[model samples]
Target: MLCPRCSLSETRVIETRTSEGGRVVRRRRECPSCGYRFTTYEKVEERGILWVVKKDGRRESFDRQKLLRGLMRACEKLPVPLDVLEEAASRIEALLRERESGEVLSLEVGDLAMEELRRINKVAYVRFASVYREFTDLSNFAAEIARLIEEREDKHDNH
Candidate 1:
């Protein structure tokens, strides 16, 4: 692995752990040159190519970075940790693979992202939902917040 700080081409893995039911490998690496330490994840890509079916009926290759970017944007300026979002994205990808389809609808991707973001942070969830669902006005935001409150209430009641 390359060191993010010094841009060294080599790094040594100091530790390794399997996570998310063995779908991901987390590695702690240290750069010999600069002594910088960082973590990286290796995910198992199961398929050759996955396509995303957008709302306009266009098919394009699924890009995990796009999902990461959206999640990062939603969690920006919040207390949400980057690693938390990364793990959530990994889980979302695993869930996508569970569908057993070569292609998945864009809306499905958004839904999964919203679900993970909701669990990680509610403010981030609303940020993602507003963009993914295309909220038009304050009433839309109000309805979403109200629904979130209701969901929390239902969960507490169940307990």
Candidate 2:
């Protein structure tokens, strides 16, 4: 690894450890030339491994941060925690990676996120669904809320 301070090509790893539930590997390094110390994180890149096919027929590389940001926005000012959203993002990424086609629709991603949010928080779910499903009018929101209520009722009956 190159040293950021002096741009030296040679660096030695001083320490190594796993983090974020073993999803990331962190390495502490020091530059021999400049004695600069820095930390580097290594994680498996899902980039180019999966593609998101947008509604307008454009294909873009799937980004986990982008997905998490959307979820955060939906849960903004709500009681939902960041860890919940992070886990949901990770689950969404994992499910997408399991696909054999190497491609998934943007709508599919949104639906997956909504599923996670719905289980975590109903308000957040509706907030996400409103934008994901493009709720332009009050009726759209009402219809979604109605469906959500009906699902709850069905589950209650089964229980």
Best by TM-score: 1
Q: What lDDT would each prediction earn against the true structure?
A: 0.89, 0.90
User: Candidate 2, residues 1-159: lDDT per residue as tens digits?
Assistant: 889999999899999998656787889999999898999989897655689999999999898999999999989999988877887898899899998899999999998998899999899999989888889999999999999999999999999
Candidate 2 regions with alpha-carbon error over 4 angstroms: 1-21, 25-42
Clashes of 2: 0
Q: Report the Cα lDDT for candidate 2.
A: 0.90
**How close to the true structure is residue 42 of candidate 2, measured as C-alpha lDDT?**
95
**Which regions of candidate 1 are displaced past 4 Å?**
1-12, 19-21, 28-41
Worst 10 residues of 1 by lDDT: 43-52
lDDT string, candidate 1, 1-159, tens digits: 679999999899999999766778999999999999999989765757788899999999888888999999999999887878877887887778777668899999999999898899999999999999999999999999999999999999999
